[model samples]
Target chain A: MSQELSDLDRRLINRLQDDLPLTQRPFASIAEELSLTEQEVVDKVRQLRDDGLLTRFGPFFDAEALGGAFCLCAMSVPEERFEDVLTKVNAHAEVAHNYQRDHALNMWFVMATETRGDIIRTAREIEHDTGLEVLMFPKKREYFVGFRVNA
Target chain B: MTLDPKDRAIIEATQAGLPLVLQPYTVVAETLGIAESELLERLENLKKNGVIRRIGAAPNHYRLGMTANGMTVWDVDDSLVDDLGDKIGALPFVTHCYRRPRALPMWPYNLFAMVHGASRDEVHAKRDRVAELLGDACRASDILFSTRILKKTGMRLRGQKG
Candidate 1:
C-alpha cells in the first residue's frame, strides 16, 4: 500500500509527473508551487530516489524512434526451473525488463535492440539459452499508458 | 521515423538526462553549438510527432506508497477487444491498456491493462470493476505482478556512435 507517503510526497508525485519547467533550477519552480525552499525540494527529490519513491527522472524517450525496436516476449517455464530460467534469460544485455505473470505465458520480458533483426535474433538466442520456447509477442500496435493514478 | 544528424546529436546529448540546472536545454544546446530555440523547437516537434512521450519525473509507484501494481490480462471476444480496451484504458486506475496477441490454449488472454493501487486488494477490486465492464465479452483473465527489474536502461540511442 502507498501508506507511507507523506502529504508533501503525494503532492510531489502528482505534480512531478508533468514535465518540470524548462528553466535553470527547475527544482526552484517546483519548490515555489509547493511553498517549500528550492533546497528542500531538491533534497526531498533526492530522498525520494533513495527511498524508491521515484524510479526515473527526466525525458521519457521513445525506443522505436531512437534507432531501436522493442518487443514483449514471454515463456512458460516448469516450476522447478523458473528462477534458473529467469537468470539465463536476463543475462542478455538486450533484455530490459522481465516479469512473472499468472498465466501460461508466465515468464515475460521485453527485448530491445538497434534493429528488428536483432530483436528476433535475441529472441531465438533466449530460447536456446533457456531451453524453453520463447513466445515472441511483438507489439503490433501500442496505446499510450497515460494512466495517472493519484497518490 | 529517424532523426537527422543534428536531431540525433541533440537526443544523444540529453538522453541520459537533462542536467538539473537553471537552463537545462541551453546547456545541452551550448554543447551542440546550436541556439537554445532551435533545440527547443526540435524537442517540441518531437513531442508533437509522438517521438518523445513526455519530459517529466517517472516516480516509482512502490516508492510513492501506491505499491500494488497488477498486469491485468483479459480474454475478451476478439471482435470486441479494441472497443472494450478503450473503455478499460480510460479508467483512471488503469494506466496502460493494449491489445496483445493470444498464445491460444495456453495463453488465452489477449487484451492487457495495467492497474495500480495502494494494496493488492485495491488492485483486485479494480480488476473486478474491469471484469464487470467487460461482462460476457471477457471469458477469463488473470493478474501478474512484476517480481524484479532484471535490467534497466533508457532507449538504445544510435547517436552515441554516430
Candidate 2:
C-alpha cells in the first residue's frame, strides 16, 4: 500500500531520520537548512506523522542503557496453536516487537524489561504459558549499523 | 545510568513521542512542571550517556515502499563472525547486524542481519551481496521473511519506580 510522496516530503523524511538538534528552536535549524520557514518544517513533520508515514518523532531510548534489559527470544509454536500461543505471549507488556517469521523458530520477538533477571523470568512465564521452548539469543556483541531510510 | 525522578517523568511524558510543534520541548517541560532549560539539559545528559540513542523520526517503511523485510541468519565461523559482522553492518543496506550465541542442535545460526527493500527479489539480491562478502567464513545461511506482525508495541516503562 505504498503512496506517492512529494519531493519535499522525500527529503524531509530522509533528513528527519538523522539526529535532530536538541535546542529550544530545533526546527529553526532544519528550516534554514531546507530553505523553509520554521513553521513550515514543523507543519510538515506534523503532517507526516499524522499521515502515518512517520511512526514516531522523538528520542529513541535504549532500555539496556537505562539499566533495563533486552533479549531476542524465539519459539517454534505449532502451526495449529500459533494463534493461541501468540495471544498468551503478547499478553505480557515485556514482549515487544513480535514477528511471525517463516522458519522453524517462527515466532521471534524481543523482550525488554526493567532488569536483566526479568528477561529469564518472562521467558519461563512464556514457556509455561505456551508449552513451548523459548530460545534466548541475547546479543553477544553488536555491530554498529546506521539505519536510515533512503526516501 | 540511574534515571532521576525528573528523568523518569520526562521519559513517561515523551516516551510515545514528542509533540509536533514549533517548540515541542516547551510543551513537554511545562507539562512536567520543569523549566525548558532544565529539561533540555537532562535530555542532553541522557543522550551523552547513551540512554537516548538519538532524537529523530522513524519512518513507516511499509508505507514508504520498503515492503520486504528479511532476517538473514548466517552460521559463520565463530572466530570470524565478529570481523565479518562489522563489514556486513557497514553495508548501507543492512539495517541491523549482531552476533548472538547459537542454540545448537536446533538453531545453528550465530549471525543475524536484517535487510529491507521494495521487494523480495531486491532483498535477496542484497542478501547475495552479503554472502559474497562473507566468502568462505559463512558455512550455511538462511533468510526468514516476516509473514506478519503479531505484536509491535515498543518497550513500555512500568509505572512504579524501579
Candidate 3:
C-alpha cells in the first residue's frame, strides 16, 4: 500500500489541504497557482484518491454550524468480540469516525447527526446492538486548531 | 443557520464528494438543475456562514508517513483548562484540540489534543513537550494511539428528513 510519490504529487497534496476557491472553475485557479494545467491538477487529485492517498475531497461541512450535532463516544469491547461489535456499531450512518484506540475503553467513535437528541438515540441503539455502555463526551468548548497534514 | 431546500439539495449532492472533473461545480450544479453561478454563490455563502469549513482534499495521514496518531488526554484544572487549552491548541504538532466534559471514575480527562508523528517514539517526544508546557497545571495525562481506523466516513446528513 506504500508507494513513493513524486515531488509534484507532494506539492499538490499540500496545496489541496488549503481552501479551494469557490469559483466555477476552482481547479483552474489551483492549476494556475501550482503551474499545472487544469487537467493535470484534476488528474492528480483523482489519481491520489484512487490510490488511497486521499480519503475524500470537496466541501467539508461543519455539522454543528449547520444545526447538526456531533458527539464523541467510546466503548470497551471484549477482545474476542471486537470485530462483531465493530460491525454492529459501524452499521449506523451516525457513526461517522470509528477508531480502535489503545485503552480500556478501546473503541472510540464520533456520532454526527441532525440533532442533539439524535445523538443519544443513536447511542442507545448501538448499546442495544453491542450490549456495551456508550460513554458520550460532548465537546464543551473547541479550541481553535487548524488540522493540516504536511505531505 | 437554517438550510433552505436548495441548500440541503446542494449538501446532499456534494457531501459524498465533488466529481473529479475539470468543471466539478458545473457538474454538481447541473445535477441539481441550477445555474453554475447560483451553485457557486450558495457555496460561498455557506462558507461565509460557517456551514462549510473548506472545499479541499483530505489526505490520509498514514499514507503521508504520519503513522503514529495519538490522542493526548489531559486532566487539567477546570479553572485553567480554557487558558491552557488555547496554548496547547496553538502547538504546531497538535492537530485537533477540544475541551470536553470528563466521565467521572473511568474517564477523568477533559482536554483532548490529537498529535500525529512518524513513529510512536516521535509522538511520545511531542507528548513530553506538551507535558512541559502544561507543567503542574495538568494533574494526569494519558495517550491513546489508534490501532486501526475502523471507519472514516465523515459527517453525513441522512437523506430522510428528521
On DockQ, the leading prediction is 2
What is the DockQ for all candidates, taken in turn? 0.54, 0.75, 0.68
For candidate 2, write residues B1-162 as lDDT tens digits: 888888988988988999988999999999999999999999999999988999989999888988999999999998899899999999988888999999998889999999999999999999999999999999999999999999988676667664
Q: Give the docking tier of candidate 1.
A: medium
Q: What is the lDDT of residue A15 in candidate 1?
A: 87
Candidate 2 CAPRI grade: medium
- Alpha-carbon shift of residue B145 in model 2 (angstroms): 0.7
* Candidate 3: C-alpha lDDT: 0.90
If you score just chain A, what TM-score does every candidate get?
Answer: 0.84, 0.90, 0.78
Q: Score residue B12 of candidate 3 by CA lDDT.
A: 90
Query: Which fraction of the native contacts appears in each prediction?
Result: 0.59, 0.89, 0.86
Best model number under TM-score = 2
Clashes of 1: 9
Two-way TM-score contest, 1 vs 2, winner: 2
Q: lDDT rank, highest first?
A: 2, 3, 1
Candidate 1 structure quality by residue, lDDT tens digits, A81-130: 98899889888988887777665667888888877899899988888887
Per-residue lDDT, model 2, residue A77, is: 90
